[model samples]
Target: MLQASFGSQHPSSDARKVADWALRSHDNRQAAFIIIDKRAARLYVLDEAGRLRGSTSVLLGAAHGDDTVPGIGQRAISEVRPGERTTPAGRFLAERGHNGRGEDVVWVDYDAGVSIHRVLTSNPGERRLARLASPVLADKRISYGCINVPVAFYETYIRPMFARQPAMVYVLPEVKSVDEVFAMAASPQR
Candidate 1:
């Protein structure tokens, strides 16, 4: 494992680059931050000091786009089409919140109904848990828009870190350049 910033082992270059940039820029403002690498289907949780708190495989949107469909969040789940389901890529100030079922979640994009919560096993057909364990990247893409993480990871790392405070969540884009998504790329170096 390649040792990156703050003792984190990042297997993907995109994830490492984003984490390094965020720390170098103080973009997180000393708050804990999360980097969700879409290509790798991995989630890295870091503390305020850029220390890796935990890492895990996660489930993302079924589609392979970076922008959310207009008014998709406002639409009922049954009304959302497959193509419209996307997890917009960018930096999000996420906070602890509850979903419709009163389950706690880290609200990534509240208006877009994009949040990071425990994996949903309600549908046996989805095979969310199995997909998470699968080696194929395609198997991981099976969520409406929200991010699904393991239950233990949620309780051990995510819940405790954001239970009382909001944090930054940088979701790497699969279709757009990082510079296009993050304005910090255009700013002068510190």
Candidate 2:
């Protein structure tokens, strides 16, 4: 296990410590859901038994920001904008699915246009494809506010979490408070 130290001045120090502890002790045996830390770039999958099944690397949003709806006649808002490669930190749900131009993908309703999906890498010339598959991307923040993963990996492992019930995907900039995220999840529209 990794350990991080925060000075007392941190705004959410207590919350961060608690979240860190939860992450460490998460038993994936019957987790049914997961919460990915953008900064950590780690995928924590819990099985039906709630034991920590294991962790894997993932590619995340290259640009980070709040998800917003675009006004009519305006440029469509992108969940991830170029050069802002930081994924938003919050709690979200895997609420839907989409035909990602032919690739199968599970859509995570981050409420910010950001969703976790299969990494698009059909083109040989795309440099991002290599990065998307790198182990380095797993434990660090990357992507445009969306979690990207190997298509087969998602189909084999992560998809089951959303089978009978909607699964939660909590993304955080760093280990911080979960109150806001939990509140959002408990909201009526969620």
Candidate 3:
């Protein structure tokens, strides 16, 4: 129960629920944080005070699972099956870093090779840009576990937040309950 406000931005019910829990329980550790609502295909960036910094639609894994397949990160991208591609749900202490390509990214789970970076338009056939612009939720699911955001959004919101310190990223589960994914010591059922 946040007495004040979640923020000026209007997030989905699930996103607000997780954000409220994180803020009330001090789960964000006074750091900037993000809430990714998988079901809604949206991402919310908030400051330490739980004020909305920005929000945007994002591209998630092609698969619908909340957990990543074991050892999938160790394998080449080409070897990963469609079903193995999943942006795992849970809280991640994410940090800003660069990929092998030297592009800046917010590493959600470095071990899992999951990061939040600008959308890739390398393959026109994938129509990543088109998918991003589409209002359809299903069109947003075409990434390989990584979270893809618009270039401007990534630069203006996500990058600066993680440039100096690590931040908490809570990816809400699609198949599991919020309680199951977070299991916060202070979380009470709504």
Using lDDT as the measure, the top candidate is 3
Candidate 2, 26: how far from true, in Å? 12
Model 3 steric clash pairs: none
Please write out the lDDT profile of model 3 over residues 1-190, one tens digit for every residue: 5521445666667787788888888888877789999998999888888888788899999999999888887888999998888999988888999998999898999988999999999999999988988999999999999999999999899988987899889999999988788777764322
Question: Deviation in angstroms for 166 in model 3?
Answer: 0.5
- What local distance difference test score does each model get? 0.86, 0.52, 0.87
TM-scores, in order shown? 0.92, 0.62, 0.93
* Regions of model 1 farther than 4 Å from truth: 1-8, 186-190
lDDT of 2 by residue, 1-190 (tens): 6222333323233334433443454422223556565555666664443345545567775544433333211334343246444455555566556543554455665344456676656555555557755667443344545677777667777666566566655555443444544443233134
Q: Cα RMSDs of all predictions?
A: 3.3, 7.4, 2.9
Task: Give, for candidate 2, the lowest lDDT window spanning 10 residues.
Answer: 2-11
Model 2 ranges off by over 4 Å:
1-31, 64-80, 83-86, 99-103, 133-142, 175-190
Better model by lDDT: candidate 1 vs candidate 3: 3
Candidate rank order under TM-score: 3, 1, 2
- lDDT measured at residue 128 in model 3 versus the true structure, 0 to 100: 94
Model 1 lowest lDDT segment of ten: 1-10
Q: How close is candidate 1 to the true structure, as a TM-score?
A: 0.92
